[model samples]
Target: MEITMYDTLLQLPLFQGLCKNDFTNIIGKVKLHFRKYNADDIIVEQGAPCTQLIFLLNGEITSQATDNQHSYSLFETFGSPFVIEPYSLFGMQTNYTATYKARTNINIVTIDKLFVLNELNNYEIFRLNYLNILSNRAQVAYEKLWNSHIGNTEEKILNFLVLRSMKPEGKKILKIKMEDLASLIDETRINVSKVLNDLQEQGLVQLSRKAISIPALEKLTEKNK
Candidate 1:
């Protein structure tokens, strides 16, 4: 079945609870600019000024952040029609928190920040949705900060696995290199290798050159608990 833009909007968390009428009103009020990107294209650089809300209409992208040591950590990978850091559009910094690069040929829709602000003020539902989105982002940020401070290597590894998995059942494949994983966790390659070996021996993960697969995600979650 073919999906319309309205259908795509409905799939997004930011547009949840908005009816067809709301979407129609939004389309009438806001102009959407469409663009395409090839694999490895940089959509936005970290710390770059951001004045538009970007939506991934199709294909894959990864967001990465650089630390004080200039090491890059994979933040998140996103698929179609999802907003890229909506909260950043409003804050005083008005800068992208991470660099977004196309992981595949991609389609994008962008709306100016002024249009977003106008909609937020004119529509009660849009205002509430925007606020809720910001709140959720803040909560996730808090959890990441808290987790960084408290966990041991093993615990942190398990927590990171759970987060990357995005669920507690079915197989989960991590498309990352061991070296990058080490950089992500700020650990040495040898240490990260040892930890992965321990997890493999315990039957929580299966390692291969291309990916790490968790056959039973629950087993990894059990370690986190």
Candidate 2:
């Protein structure tokens, strides 16, 4: 494998904390499914079966999540060293929650879900990491669910971003209309615009004609706290 490939593999959470030998052995034992895409190419569609664990090895990708019934949608951009919907691989859904598109020329590396269950689970560190990832997602989701109805407009907006994201710490770009956003959070359009402007003044977000960009989600979360 190329050094770049090795570095990329190690960057993913599932492969972190594994010793060098284990990493090499695991790679040698499996055939990595690799693909490349041009900007604007569709990587996967929403509701498609997530039969493998896909790693964004290079470049950037944008994902769109539409509400059930196609009422509204949320779009987010994620860079490399990322995984696409790991939690969806084995759950009752077993399908991608969003449609992902290439935002730049990108490389993808995937591991079959069967290999994940039958092979990757053999490594104790890998198992623990997977458990931690899934458990964190579930616990955060449960807590968020309980608080879904009680936050103020600002809190509701922040929770909207957090609950819809793939991870809580990355720089994320969200594409949605002002009115659509307000409807999703159960606030009026005027209220949503006011809170968004306040957030922009606080330097927590940048508003554009087409989208809202968050430089660092962690900062927004901390400021809210």
Candidate 3:
């Protein structure tokens, strides 16, 4: 069967539990803006006023943030249909926290903030779903802040491992290159490689060409304590 836009939106966290009739009600009430982006397109820049709640319907997008040193760091990459920066829609200073760029040809659906507010007031499920999504994002921000305070390279590596491995799909394996991993942690590739070598010797992880497999995730988590 051919899936419709409503079907895709239903799979997203914001609309997960919402039925077709609920979606129909939403469609009837809000004017959704659709946009198509080619690879390398800037979807939204950091500090730009956030006037709409954007939902990525197809393709991939990368979010990057600049630190105090003016260095850009990769914040996240979203592949499936999901809300982008719902927290930015509110607050006194309503702006995007990071720059979002399309990594491939992308399609997006956007709803105005006023309409979103109305929906939140009208639908209990959407309000709960949005709150849960925001909470998860806040937790991730907390982890990044916590990781930044660790001064030891080995400890930082362990913390990074623990954080990523906590993900459901990242339970045993971390499929990332040493260079990219180094960039993520703001360390040199050599330093990351040395730490991985030490981890391998300690039987904490098994390293290959493109991935690092943790034999015992608890071993890495225990080191963080």
Candidate 4:
């Protein structure tokens, strides 16, 4: 589906306050690209070169991380105008740190690194905007790393789930399996199960044979606090 220039800028968080003509100019520089993927499609692999800045126009995407043998889902989902990793755009590192996949059909707009570099060289405002975006993204990455390396397993699991809860239709009933939880928490399934059982025993969650449900989200969040 073709999108108008105005609609593109409106969907972008960084371009929210810009006028219509400014959006038109930006859109002229950006090349809109569409990709349709089946469920569980890998969009970008970890350690692969990240060549463009992407703006999601439709559908859902998730990012996962892998360190050699182990893999963990970084975020349950990302939708619309969310830049993959802005830090790579300015020629820091090229490879994608996380593997991204389509949870549903995805439509994206791409601005090539060369294109961004050329534009930024001339447009001070756009350069600042891009840099600010990258700075914020880097900070988030740092925080996630700090938590994973220093925080306890239970804290990590709680933090990860709390973030997932912000997604659309995200709620207490987590359908994710023990293996996925173990991956996210960097724990073995046995240990994950034990902690989950502890949370269940405390009335924070309800774990059935198939799915786990959080009876009190507030209580689950209290662990994070």
Candidate 5:
């Protein structure tokens, strides 16, 4: 069982460069923590303090962020071997930016910040991997902003979603009213509605009252490109 766990750790981003020997040493060094959740279970709520590095081992989960005024929530789904916002751990706003929930039976392993600071930091490879991930996230965000521009109403909406997304490709859910969404994207309500209707007709999104469900963000991205 421990062997399987070590192998799984190797697949996780934060532990990627570490060899089997390193994982074994870490396991022996700390009281490893594990947790599980059933489908639809809430793993963590938005604004909660992030005191540990939470790694999703298997299954899928979604992270949701709400606008400050609680206008609408943005959600993005990700699969296994995921890390839940590692950058939040040491920032001025130490709270998790989103609420995360399980989309399947999920298993997670977490390393407390203290161990990450005192012990994991001692490993040169581990420190480099950590720094790389943080740097990559910042760089991606910076580059994406340059790509964000107002095009057609459809492209405007797509850019809005993609810019806020954790990953460019995933299942996405945008819960906002037509007027609110239109105002945010700087499009007319009628134009927004017309484009959304056209998208729905094309089977790209399923629209209901105040919600737009995108089953495959990648498919829509591919179609546009």
Candidate 6:
């Protein structure tokens, strides 16, 4: 059977910035498919073994989980080529903690897990690249988990603002809903609203209908610390 390559794969952040020839070579070994799903369609469920390294070509993925008290939505819409779980490729036996669903029509390219491992193991560059990506993802996950549990409400809010700043175009206005902030900090919407109100009163964050923007981010972080 002949495998077809795709240009869209190069557009994803994971493959973006890679040399065109390098991406093309990788695509040559991949199997391309367009997966269409409606909102709430399960893309990958918890406890299911990861068979392929799914490169999300388009649309959004939401990961959610429920604890004893309430269900927490970890992500509302994370973008493409985000690995659902990297350890799946390493033969780890742990079950998935969260369920992944499509927030809209989703397009994906799935490469054979075995094929990628075999090729990457033999190629030093590919091995380094793969490890680097996994390490970065792990760190992000760790930070999210750690911040949600230990920090005070003020500290949590400050940390979120600083984190956004670390990304590209960090100075741009962040218009996030109260619910997203609450979810990120593991607080209830009501609690988040109260915190936001206090921050507004103290001139830490500015609040408006449908948006909460942080103006003096550095000062807020220092105050929290």
Top candidate by TM-score: 5
Name the regions of candidate 5 deviating beyond 4 angstroms: none
lDDT of candidate 2 over 56-127, digit per residue (tens): 998999888877652556677788888999999986789999999999999999999888988899999999
Give the per-residue lDDT digits (tens) of candidate 6, residues 58-176.
Answer: 77776654332332222334666555665566645745655688877786666667777665355555666677877886687567556545677777766665443322111223456
Candidate 5 per-residue lDDT, tens place, 1-225, comes to 577777887888878889888777887786668999999999889999999999999999988899978499998999988999899999789999999999999999888999989888888988888899999999989977876775789988888888888888868999999999898888899999999999999988889999999888877878777
For all candidates, the clash counts are 1, 0, 0, 0, 0, 0
Measured on C-alpha atoms, candidate 6 has an lDDT of 0.61
User: How do the residues 1-225 of candidate 1 rate in per-residue lDDT, one tens digit apiece?
Assistant: 134867886677667778888778788878879899999999999999889988887898877665445333434566776788787887688898778999899988888988877774577766787899888767766665667624666776666655533223556566577887777777778887898889899998888874676677777766677
Sort the candidates on TM-score, descending order: 5, 2, 1, 3, 4, 6
| Candidates 2 and 4 compared by lDDT, better number | 2
Judge candidate 1 at residue 96 and give its lDDT: 84
Q: 180, model 4: CA deviation in Å?
A: 13
Candidate 3 segments exceeding 4 Å error:
1-3, 68-72, 139-152, 157-193, 196-225
List the candidates' TM-scores in order: 0.73, 0.85, 0.69, 0.67, 0.94, 0.59
Candidate 3: clashing residue pairs, number? 0
Q: Residue pairs in steric clash, candidate 4?
A: none
Model 5 accuracy (lDDT, Cα): 0.88
Worst 10 residues of 6 by lDDT: 164-173
lDDT of 3 by residue, 1-225 (tens): 135777888898888898888788888888889999999999999889999989999998876654435232424566868677888888787998778899899999889989988764489889998889778877886776677537677777766654533232223555667887787778899999998898899888788877777765666767656
- Note the Cα lDDT for every prediction shown: 0.73, 0.86, 0.75, 0.65, 0.88, 0.61
Clash-forming residue pairs, model 1: 56-81
Residue 120 shift from truth in candidate 2, angstroms: 1.6
Please report how far candidate 3 places residue 41 from its true position, in Å: 0.8
